[model samples]
Target chain A: MLTLHNYFRSSTSTRLRAALNLKGLDYDYKAYALLKKETQTPDFLARSPAGLVPVLELDDGTALSQSLAIIEYLEEEYPDPPLLPADARGRARVRALAYMIACEVHPLNNLRVLQYLATQFDQDDQGKAAWFNHWVHQTFRPLEALLADSPETGRYCHGDTPGLADCCLYAQIWNNRRFKVDSSPYPTIERIFAALDELEPFRKAAPPEQPDAT
Target chain B: MLTLHNYFRSSTSTRLRAALNLKGLDYDYKAYALLKKETQTPDFLARSPAGLVPVLELDDGTALSQSLAIIEYLEEEYPDPPLLPADARGRARVRALAYMIACEVHPLNNLRVLQYLATQFDQDDQGKAAWFNHWVHQTFRPLEALLADSPETGRYCHGDTPGLADCCLYAQIWNNRRFKVDSSPYPTIERIFAALDELEPFRKAAPPEQPDAT
Candidate 1:
């Protein structure tokens, strides 16, 4: 069986869960207590050197780190119920949107990055929270405009079917709400989330629905 | 012909250049002066909302953003040189290594992020330089250790052949030297860089070799 070594609240982990469920793949969920820093331990570090969440361990004893990489691998190996768009151009667009969140927004607010800010810069909890929401709001505005105005957007971020961009959008929205980000400006995003909420796959993949959620 | 909208010194742009050269693909280079903040213009933002460089426009008039996405598209479309390994595990491992540099390292040292610390946080040139080298060191220590101790690392980062990981590794090393980062501590990394520097494709893609280089 495929085992996903993940943390319930991690946006990275959330991405994997949504992808897995959407692709109709059955997997075992193994949660790492991230708040307690279980991810930093030697065992988890051996599986993933960077010591981050969403390490997907395949049945053949292969451990894949990085959520985007793992998702792409799944897409490559399992072609049905495609998570990405068909054409190369569409794939690139979907990937670019995903990177906008993965590379630009999520990294800045990750637990490790936030911890570094707090420890190195002497930022208090309030300052840390402010830092987190600032990036979220900055990215969300452009995303909202794109989803609301673009011809490509349908029930999801890309089209009527749920795809790669939707996977990222859903996970990030969950993170935003958890942080109490004012998502009022992104009605399109809210509408898309509502659309995703109606789907059993996305709902089943929610953090609250995961085994590790307290 | 494919068109690359890029900034000469941008790490992401450098990444695309290396892959394009390695694939022996011809591209029309349209240089945008990043220092002048031309990337924020409405024209540029239409293709990439994040207002970043290294957007690849294909023959079909479809634009691709994000360096990694562009490279992957090239790898998939033109399979002659085969930038990725054949097996799924190997592919996942290579992609993970690529993300270790792209997501974990380069995002922390991008031009916009550095400028943000300078203007927003009152960090001076020295402070910014410290910030850049800090991430390089933090990521390089583990990267060097991974390369040095692992038998999988050969003349390049992954295997004897130049692959996706090498593309990312070379770009980061080239940027590190531009900032006058001391690379003595990472002997294995230095050795790999020396090997990569000898390659014609890697040589032609170096920042100083670019047509728009300052």
Candidate 2:
């Protein structure tokens, strides 16, 4: 059994949950309130030094931090429904797409970064939303171009299968809705998000579907 | 032969270069001046839709984007000296350590992000450096703790051999020097970085050694 320590609204947590559901792996869900700084506790910090969400605790008490790393661990350990592609090039493509969101968009729009903006720069809600949308569009523009132009993109960000990139893409879309970011400009991304939203695994991973959604 | 498209000072580029050097792979280095908006050119954007540097052009003209993804591809295609450990848990540990820098620190302290603070928020050099150091220390504290306490850690981030995490750590240390960040607080990181610096593979990949280095 695995114990997942996470918050509902965290896009990274959403990614891990989607991956877990897709793998058909059952786990114990433990919620932490991000707004109240619950992850800043000594216990949580002991589990994940960074004190971020989606720490997958194994039965042996081995805690895996970082959503992508955990998902990769699951992929390797389980290997039943692969989140990455078979070939090296294909896997590279999927991981690259996943990184675009994971490394670019989500990092900038993370709650901590947003709080930094508010505290350090005196940015208000409007200013923070602007900052969020700026990064979202910056990466989303190129992401849409890559996905739309590639012959490799099928029902998901990779092939016909829902893989690593789709997990990131699906989670990001849910995060995007909070700012009311218009997806009309990215038809390919919009289509893929729609397709992913239809799937039970992804839908169940949505923020609103989580136990701690508030 | 592979063509490495990158900027001399980009930490991501440095990561890729270190990986290539470690793997004993030869590549034709193609420099892009990030400050001059060289990567924003139509030609470069065609190669990498994200308009980012360190695109690995394969023999078949396939351009791979994202430094970590490219490194993973190199590890898979040419497995002579494996960059990742053989076990799944080891790989997860290495990748998590790498992502702590890649996803958390680098994204926030990137050149463009600094420029954003300058242009959009009226931040000067002092402010930018403060911003840079803030994110660096935020992650480095836990990173230092993780490295110091983990029995899995050896000469590098995972085990005695240098691998994925070392590449990220080495590049990040170089990036930190630009801001003149004090590394003394993290003795473990300082020691690992010093060990890596002594190696020819890592020494050759330093920013000052790049062809287009200013």
Query: Positional deviation of B137 in candidate 1, in angstroms?
Result: 3.1
Per-residue CA lDDT of candidate 1, range B166-205, in tens?
A: 8998899888987889999999989988999999999988
Where is model 1 chain B poorest over a 10-residue stretch in terms of lDDT? B113-122
Interface RMSD of each: 1.7, 0.5
Distance (Å) between predicted and true CA of A151, model 2? 1.0
* Root-mean-square deviation of every model: 2.0, 0.7
lDDT of 2 by residue, A1-214 (tens): 9999999999999999999999999999999999999999999999899989989999999999999999999999999899998999999999999999999999999999999999999999999999999999999999999999999999889879999999999999998999988788999999999999999999999999988898
Worst 10 residues of 2 chain A by lDDT: A175-184
* Model 1 stretches with alpha carbons more than 4 Å out: B149-151
Model 1 misses residue B97 by how many Å?
A: 0.6
Instruction: For candidate 2, write residues B42-157 as lDDT tens digits.
Output: 99898899999889999999999999999999999999798899999999999999999999999999999999999999999999999999999999999999999999999888
